[model samples]
Target: RKFWALARTGQGTTLRGNDQVNGYLLLATSCDGTLATTATPTTVRVVCNNTLTIALDGTTRAIKVPHNTRFDPQAVKKQLGIAVSQWDTFMHRMRTLSERKVQWHEAMGFFMSVVCDVPPNSKLPEVLPNERALRKVQSLYEGGGRGATLESAQGTAWGLLNAVTEYVDHERRARSTEYRMDSAWFGQGAFIKQRALQAALQLAA
Candidate 1:
């Protein structure tokens, strides 16, 4: 089962680039134990239909209950109540990131840090960044991505972060559309986006 609750304001927030987006509280679960029951706060970009889960605090994005455990609607709703109250705080952070400008070199480094894969204990001299992915994301950030030219995104950490999300959500290669959606929301793409968010936040800081 899946559910969505729109923000109480009923109006989209204007991000730094003049982009407008609506925030939502998402609740998803599966009876067959295929998926964990989770309550997550997410935002949907109106321009490109891209989504990014909001990190309520510095790190926590969602509250989850393993399928093995009995599903408790009241408990989940209680957690979501707290998360919903923090929407303003999360938007504040996003606005701060948008106001933080990023140079081309800094953006490149941020993207590399996000897309490059190096084993924690590997002894390799240097692991090459995913050149294909790098180029695509770079192009997106440099006005090729959706909403890239918006005031909030142009030359800002928020824009760079959105670029990564756009790639993962719309441009990344997948076996099929369903597969892409699945990955974007619940698989490797999700991890990439979370990493991108953290990297961008660090840059903004």
Candidate 2:
């Protein structure tokens, strides 16, 4: 029997396909010692446990990795959370430091430019207190130090906020096309949490 599934629902190993059919195919392939993700009578891509082999017609293509691949949702989520948290902390630090100066708003504008994806014209000229993290924004003309160069503050906040905008755009694109809506939702949920953290940081600043 030729079995191919794109949706492994119950199986926790893969979010791309359902597990029931996968279980049957797995058993059959294991017994036959021939498992394939592609269903081509002339070309079959097979994986036997950790080992992978591709057979084209009667000819063997190559022998590669031999290990069962497993995907853990918990692990993936944890990693994503950690990554976002790091970015959030870095942004918060930059914001906090910028707020200390008399021209804090100007510095904020520069900071936003570095991190955000906002339109050039719409970016803030002043370091508008974001929720409280005073972000130091540097302009293109500004030197390496913590202050904003000659660039105005209006666009700086826009730049910082642009990061959030970029994130939202990425989420929208990812959700628009995949069958993994749950994962998509999870991604957006993380974004929301990160934004909230940034907002909280601003409030505390």
Candidate 3:
């Protein structure tokens, strides 16, 4: 069960409802009298015939690996963490905009801009999983990753931050409009009145 959950991150092949699922592929192999290397492009299912018991973080949680499993569990964990963190940061920035009633499309536009810059060839393999493959996975993420060149990485980080700042500005302007409208229409709500008064105080400061 633990293996199945963790394996989801590396799994690309999917099963459609009322459809079939392709079995795993053999991504690596070893032969006698020859140096061991990664598997060639083949249709063989990558399976772990040997059992490996690994304690994930020394907690009760552990991974059970059957033989013929070529994928590295540790590498998978690291990449998953990186990928999740990237999404988390993006979502957090978006949340700030939402709290201030900023347009949802604007937040999505910011995310799309960063996503567009990722190199196409930088994509990872669909089947075989390894450290190199994991690095490729991290590259897909907008946040920092091992594959980031010093130039590209710094630029991307700065771009995302700038987008956040722009969103904040739009949010403030949008709030000001709403506050003005509320005063002109309902002519109520002490909260709005107080907010306007505070804005005046801050502007004077």
Candidate 4:
């Protein structure tokens, strides 16, 4: 497949399905397996694709860098340190999710209630979209896939949230990988994750 070059840096290239750049895949050095955000010269991480979407990787994952920012690879890499305060909050949420266990059926139901099976929520605005969303979400919670493995998804809110994030970033149908990345970070998928996060927080409470 062909991709349009969206951004070029001393690190690597960010490619898009088109010039629109709602999102693009990033190819960069691993920075020893750490990932964080940057702001000087105006860098912003809109989406991180694939496993990188969830964490940082050495090679390609989707993202959006600000147009005005200078793509200095070293500068970008220098910014790769965990945000301590943010991670504390994130880990707390994850802990809550892990501790609050539910049965398989309940996990499935919670996921269904969160995924957008209807408009203004569904990533697919038309074309049997609601059904598509329902099926996609169902498969992630119960399908015999890595994200759906019972150990990962059947008993805890953390697992369920992980499954949803993994599915949205990698498995859900989209116009392109770039579109999927955009949705995962900025569009419907992002909203769904927020809902899932909120629901998870509630469960913890």
Candidate 5:
């Protein structure tokens, strides 16, 4: 099932250029028990069709019901209603991130920290960044990313966070579009994004 709804207030933010950003509430479920009934707050970049979940206080702010349990539409609605009320707070945080300028070195470090891997039995000094992914994300964060040049994004933590989201949603390798979408929303891609959000928030802080 697919549907779209606009926010009642604080509809969106217009960037310095033609790009605009809008918030959405995404609901999904599966009958075969492959997926959970979840309501996630999301944001879309109109220019490139990139998406990011609205995370607050390092949480995805998603409400989920396992398929094994009975579905409760009203209860889900109540939780969603509370989530919706956080739109203003979320946007305020985004604005703060946008204003928090980042140097190129800081941005590089941020990406390294996000995508690094430490082999089992390896020491902290052996932690290594995923070179290919690092290069791609760095390029995006440095201006190749969608909306990268927008005033709100250029050299800012908000922009850095969006860079990671854009990569996961549109550029990451996948066997098929469907697989990519599934991962972006509910699998490993989701975890990567959450990590990026937390890192970005730390950078801004």
Candidate 6:
């Protein structure tokens, strides 16, 4: 049996996600309303899922492809000629984070602040997961492998940013590989990375 893979690029659509996840950005042209794909690149998760298939080439923007287009295998291979390296992306981001410095206490405090900010009047269901998120961050801070390192650049903004990414990409529990991929790109994990990125960038100022 032979399987065919297709590549499409264009404006992507986003679906709302639960508290644990953020949302899905549908990216494929010929999706059967339930097929999807996601790549674990820095700053974004390329994805396909939940009732649609569309493709987009973007870091922070989605450009949609038409649904009726078709291409042969050679075309697919040529377009996506080589695989993107996650480590390369990480090192690039590390350069930025390394520029910004933070103390160990500040790093821990940052995660502490990431726990959901509850309104004065909140729904019961929302609180637990948010609390769990806080605990998860705390766990990572206390002893999440290299996440606990406090040395040179490792203990500052660079370390904290890595802590969040490592937790999202390697630590956080997921239902399956697909689920983890989706969450890493479109769910809470992505949001956390973005937040950390923003925080890290702020330090550079």
Q: CA lDDT of each candidate?
A: 0.80, 0.28, 0.27, 0.47, 0.78, 0.45
On TM-score, the candidate that comes out on top is 1
lDDT of 3 by residue, 99-176 (tens): 232233332333333223222235534543233422332333233322222232222332232222222222223348
Best by lDDT: 1
Better of 2 and 3 by TM-score: 2
* Candidate 2 TM-score, C-alpha based: 0.20
Kindly state the number of residue pairs that clash in model 3.
15
**Model 5 spans > 4 angstroms off:** 1-10, 15-19, 117-127
TM-score of each: 0.85, 0.20, 0.18, 0.52, 0.85, 0.51
Please list the residue runs of candidate 6 whose C-alpha ends up more than 4 Å from where it truly belongs after superposition: 1-30, 33-93, 118-129, 147-153
How large is the C-alpha RMSD of every model relative to the true structure?
3.6, 19.8, 24.8, 11.9, 3.8, 11.0
Which window of 10 residues has the lowest lDDT sum in candidate 2? 43-52
Better of 1 and 4 by TM-score: 1
In terms of lDDT, the poorest run of 10 residues in model 6 is 13-22
Ordered by TM-score, highest first, the candidates read 1, 5, 4, 6, 2, 3
Tens digits of per-residue lDDT, candidate 2, 1-205, equal 2223232112112111121001111111122325432211111111111111112222322212112545455754554344323323343343442233324544343334324423234746454433222222132213322222312212233223322322332332343534223222224533432442343234335
Give me the displacement of residue 25 in model 2, in angstroms: 34
Model 4 per-residue lDDT at 203: 60
Candidate 4 C-alpha lDDT tens digits along 1-205: 2123233232221222110112222332224323322221111122322221222111112333343556777644544322211333444445556667777656645665667433233354445535676666666556544534443235567556656666777788899988886676556876666676665566667
Q: Give lDDT tens digits, candidate 6, residues 1-205.
A: 1112323332232212210111233333324623233222222222212111111221343322233445355644443322222233433444555656666656655665444543223444433545666666666655564424444234566556555666676666888866765665566776666666665655544
Q: lDDT of candidate 6 vs native?
A: 0.45
* Model 3 deviation from the true structure expressed as Cα RMSD, one decimal place: 24.8
